[model samples]
Target chain A: MSKHRLLAMFKGFDDSLPVLRDIKAGGCAGVSIDDVDYLSPIEHPDIDEILERKVNVQKFTFTGAVFGVTFGFFFLASAQASFLVQPQGGKAVVPFPTNFVLMYEMLIFFGIWTTVFSFLFLAGLLRKRGTLYSEKLTVDQCGIMLEVDEHKLKSVKEYFKKQKSIEIREEAVT
Target chain B: MEIKDKIIDENLGWQRINEDVIRSMDAPGKYYWITFAVCIAMVLCAVAAEIYQYRMGMGTVGLNNPHMWDMYIATFVFWIGMSHAGTLLSAILHIIHAQWRKPIYRFAEAMTTFSLMTAGFFPMIHLGRVWNLYWVLPYVSDRGIWPNFRSPLVWDAFAISTYLSASALFLVIGMIPDMAILRDHAKGWRRKAYGILALGWRGDDRQWRVFRKTYMLMACFLIPLAVSVHSIVSSDFAMSIMPGWHVTTFPPYFVAGALYSGCAAIMTLFIILRYFFRMEEYMTLNIMEKTCKLTFAIAMVWSYLNIIEFASTWYGHNTYDKELLINKANGPYAHIFWLMLFCGSVAPFALAFQKLRRHMPTMFAVSLILQLGMFVERWMIVAPTLSMAHNPHQWDVLYGSIIEWAIVFGSFGWFSLLFLVFVKLFPSVSMYEVKELTFHLKHEMEEEKEAAATSSKSKAGAVGKPGLEGA
Candidate 1:
């Protein structure tokens, strides 16, 4: 046997907490807190308390924005100067106002795309179809997916059962 | 107390919200078919008109030298202005955390992207040579020439593409959660379709966290981007030395006008969606009143800005500006100008009446009037200025020919076509957000009841005992 993958589903927000705390407290032998994942229909800020690292998407957003502004300005300056060899209506070769407008748009344009892609990546979306799930999870139920060793599967299942989980699913890999 | 009614039906459970919203995506009714068929016919007519115009050149649509920026540009601005409805309800109201917007924002966001798709066509249509349109792009060419980025036309190209891209992204990204809900519930080919669009969303705590952040960040970007876009559109006229078009207040005026038209459009769609989908629980009368209030406020802002533009023209004493202003009031466009002023400025006062706001049919008529007013305002902006420009020799009065009018109506058809297809394919109301709103309002209502019960108990005890330590 390789490892036991299990999901515990609960009907209420607070109902998921005790099991989450059990894994976080290291009370569950052969189970790692890092392997536990939470599934919810809505945002639960309390879920962040158990995770070691908070999701940091704004960094990716800012980096993309900075890059967009830098690239946008330079491209406008260089492109206008190198090509428009003739005088432009006796005005500056590259005007700042128009260029600035495009640059600001680029900042948002780049920032939005980067945030979306990074969210897709960090959230582990578009991964191989998840093995353990319930239709109820996306509706009223909350799901917690975790990996456990075969030796500890029975005990963890019992622990989840004691909390009166609405449902429990498992995929054991050999 | 009726005014304080919950925005969505708090009595609804999570599963009910899902079922109701998903049911809206089921087979549409007879009215939908009739309207959709009309839209398809309009689009077909427009396509024929465009083909004729393309073959005969822009002149066939009645474009003389003076009326070059005719109905196409004004309709382009109209569609662009209509796109702002989604931004107003989705982006601006999102940042403010207006829960009432939850049920309606999806359709508004869809309108934003689809109207943009429609608006993008006008510039291409207005081009004398539509095939040679890529020359406006800043790409490297065989001739070693580049587009003049200094032109406000160029600014428009950039602003529109960016606005379109971001808004489209915003619309799709916001739909992911709801798509996942549909994905779980749908079957057969529908499942596969929604599954692909759902992007493997599991609605995990982490995904929701990142989704919320990304949604907010995008909303933050969209508001200013929307403002900047209309401002740039204003510059297409303002940058020109045209007497009536060069007002400094044009940007704010345009933005205000865009929001006013956008809000009115939202009301029209809101009533339609509510009636058709039986989404009365979500699109409640109280919420409609709130939307009416917001629209009334923006209409006032637009009216003030209109006055400011006129007052500036009167005081500045620019001979050309004053003469053009007088001509607009007394010239060929005078009827349209006064209609715009009356419809946009005066008619919205109906919203201030509670009975009128609560009456759906009255509000619907008012919304249509506001749209007509905004359309006239754009026509007045473009037509009168060009007709009475600095050089009188280039002056020509243009009432759009049949071809131009046909194309304008067709754009509306195209937008409706997209919107009709979207509602059929996707849930017009956001399911998860409505569930969340229900959750919040339920808790608040429960807390209020509990508070009321506790107060009554305390008062009863005090009446019997004359005093109590805790009381």
Candidate 2:
């Protein structure tokens, strides 16, 4: 069956929170709250509760940092070993202290690139399908969009209206 | 509900902030175009001079055996130092949750990215054969030779490239949400441009969560990276066998000087941006005052380091170092050295007075003079030491030729042009961060009022009690 999507806009973050809470509560009453998304000009504190359910990018960051440290040391050590055994003056062939500088820099370099990679990967950036968005959401308004059953659409719209949503947009989703 | 409504409503509304900042991206006044044209002319002149120098060889710009590293290297260091204030200031302030940084950090970070780009050109220019510059990279070649891992120069290549990539990413990541704001408001070509740059930023909670985490992680990474980048640059001189250059204190000394000059540059740009963009409301007098205070503190730190460097040289009694120090004070460069003292050491004291700090014209002039001092300071570090090195027979005064002067002028113009284009393309002031600041301020005020009401209510209840002795 084709589903309906409802997008409700509110003037303030505080006003939007109650609507989001009610939408979550509505799911317990047999209404399919298939997905809920909150949009705002600035990140709102209440959004943290919803974010707990999303994929964590920090794990990727950890993995990247580990790889960076390991690769940094390995690259320097191997470079030293690859050169001819002609010791410059009385110094050691592999100067560990001096090599640490490049290794340190590489650690930061790899760590940053991996963090960026993970963000792009998990955030689903450069995706083919665009998200449901409203221009006003980037300005003074806050938005809540939900995919719900058609029978529950009227109740959802009424609930949002009662909660003082400034604008409500509805569209059919196949 | 009333409390929520009152707390949510702020003086600088989201719509107003958007309109004020995004207006600069619209058709700027005729003056902007004129300034832009002048910058382009300067840049072209610089490019012409570079081509001339390239054809005539390194001899066109005044380099000799003893004094091999001259104005190009000095200017390179100056620009690298100038780049430090932006990322260091933004990252450090953001980490500490300094709300005042919201309006200025965007431009400051842009400065970091552009100055690094400008600084990157110098080593190539100094290389004479700029074409073979990629030899510094550590790639395995058919010759089976690898870049020496022990060389500080190699360390510099790694540090600078890493910093450039990291800061550039940091800059872009911070701008995504703001770009999304512009994408929504813009039309035609602007819409397409911002839409692509915005990376489909939809302001979803999930995306923001990851963004904030990533941004914080980068900031944490950047603080150390910024410090290390300058330290490695300083190592270029410190690790050398030259007497005056081989000082243990050079790293910290260079870092302090870099921050000092960088802060001054930021003040210079801050005032100019305020005047041009009508951003007086955002870049208010109070913010300028705080910035001046920070600059003054850094100036004092740099001056302290300078004294320590001089004192240590005089006390250590190393013949080459002492000779260089004496020559710096009483040699042909004496006038420039004294001028550096006055500009770097004395002028920043003017900021100590509130009247002078708040006076835009006075502060602007002081910033320019301070930067002059810094430029000369870099020159002094290079020329005097090389001129009065261990072998007295080779000592001779080296000066920059006309080509060097043109390139210096062009570098300033190039930096300005990049900044101008950036301001036009992106919202120079961060839109969302500023809104966040406004919200926090409003919330704080509401909380204070509620606390006061609660205290008064309890006091009234106690006063009405019959058991009160005063009653």
Candidate 3:
């Protein structure tokens, strides 16, 4: 039978671990197997069964590739226009040695353009809601969201009931 | 949290400059006025000389067939060399992660733009028929006069233009935020002037985003421009069949020499600005020491290149190249060449010691000497080669006439005058970046302080607080 809420008794031993374990074992089925919930000893081996996921956001890498492309295109275009048109002093049109100068210039120009622009774009800046990041996150905090349905709400609440120290609160992504 | 705040903190090393700038502007003492007057007067003299050159034609300058380049081309090279200061300070320093570069980047960029403008003048004036200067472009003509792309001269024109535009744009982009600050602080017509230049900047994230992106772009653009500009300049000499000018390594050698001299020039300016503007607090000994190290390192590279160049000349066993190289060390221009070696190499080598690098007076003196040595090097490069041209029968030794000397002197005056005027008009150090860096440094310090406090209060406080969550 599905249970609504289970209020297991806990004291000392930093209550969070047993509460977390209950949630993990309970499997959001709204049922608790043990009847008389009591405080577990600090050295209890059952706590080892609890699992946690590790996650982190990584900084975006700047490639400067687009910058290179823009530069290459510009230089190629400018080279085709200037040196590639008429052969100079009986030399072949688009003299490879000389046109390399234009290539050098374009690479510089485009590389810079890409590096700067990409940094801005990747930083999530200049958008409508830019600069609106939660200031509190700069200090100490962590937010872990657990999805719950109405059918399992009782079980989760009961599990959290044992974790009185955790300061659980309802939240929506809105 | 924000990069801007990170850059604006108190110990971030900009408080002294901020205070000194305020003092200089408000006080305007006797020496300030005197310096202003002298700068203005010199600027006027340069203007007069330009007008005179225009009226009297290129004949007024001492340009002959064999030594056609004369002072103008030498001055062009000199100014171009000077322009390297900005790119080295701003772009290269940024790339290499030199923090001291923050305060000096703007002025360095200004140096690039203005020196380029000055350098551009020489080519026009040297052409004599300044109006027909457009004929150098690749255009269809009845005479079928196409610019010789093989000629380094044409390449120089393109390289200089591209570099000048890129540099100017970079400078303007970097200055926008600071211009906004200036606008806020200014009154009357000055406010309006700054307002226009500020480009409606607010400290919004969008502007900052674009600004940062553009700045990074500029840095990326500038490094290659820096290398290419000097390489093309060297090409002007190398493409020639002249003995000393016909080396394959001239491109990189010239680039190194340009950067060495450029860094020294920037150091000299930094020293002058520090004392004159009472900016010692902002431009600290730390910055001086770091820049001196850079200067010293580049100096060493230059020394190595110098040896390599000479060694190649000897190894090649080309009679003409060998003779010219020996003559550089022991010929008619031997004294100046030796002096160049002593100042450019010997003086800077002493800076290898940490103590010597930190000594302000010694550092300044060395920088000045290096600049002087570089000038002599440029003169030696141009003059001695022409004097020892192929035809011994036509071996007319080149000497600077009074007119040539006047023009050279006038160009120096012009450059200084423009710099002085720029100092008066704009904030010599960037206020926005300084503020942003200062703010960030302070915020980080506060975070550290808070962390320490919390740690002491609770043994497990840090773990519970979730450091770097989703970082």
TM-score per candidate, chains pooled: 0.96, 0.95, 0.72
In model 2, the runs with Cα more than 4 Å from the true position are A23-28, A31-34, A85-87, A129-131, B1-10, B469-471
Candidate 3 lDDT over residue span A1-174, tens digit each: 332222233333344444555555874464442321222211122333343221111111124444454555554455445555454467666466765675566555545555444544543333443121221111111112244555666556665564563334443322
Candidate 2 lDDT, B288-375, residue by residue in tens: 8888999999999999999999999999998888888999999989999999999999999999999998899999999999999999
For every prediction, compared with the true complex, DockQ reads 0.72, 0.70, 0.07
Clashing pairs in 2: none
Q: Which ten-residue region of model 2 chain B has the weakest summed lDDT? A: B1-10
Arranged by TM-score, best first? 1, 2, 3
- What alpha-carbon RMSD in Å does predicted model 2 have with respect to the real structure? 3.1
Each candidate's fnat, in order? 0.71, 0.67, 0.14
**Alpha-carbon lDDT of model 1:** 0.87
TM-score of chain A of each: 0.89, 0.84, 0.36
Ranking of models by lDDT: 1, 2, 3
Q: Report model 2's TM-score to 2 decimal places.
A: 0.95
lDDT of model 1 at position B150 = 81
Native interface contact recovery, model 2 = 0.67
Error of 2 at A50 (Å): 6.1
TM-score of chain B of 3: 0.88
Query: Total clashing residue pairs per candidate?
Result: 0, 0, 21
How would you encode candidate 1's per-residue C-alpha lDDT over B1-471 as one tens digit per residue? 133566766778888888888898888789999999999999999999999988898888778777879899999999899998797568988999888888889999999999899998999999868888898776656787777788888888888888998999998998998889999999999999989999999887778888888889889889989998899999999999988999999999999999989899999999988998898888999889999999999999999999999999999999999999999999888999999999999999999999999999999999999999999999999999988988878778887989999999999999999999999999898888887887787777878889999999987888788546555
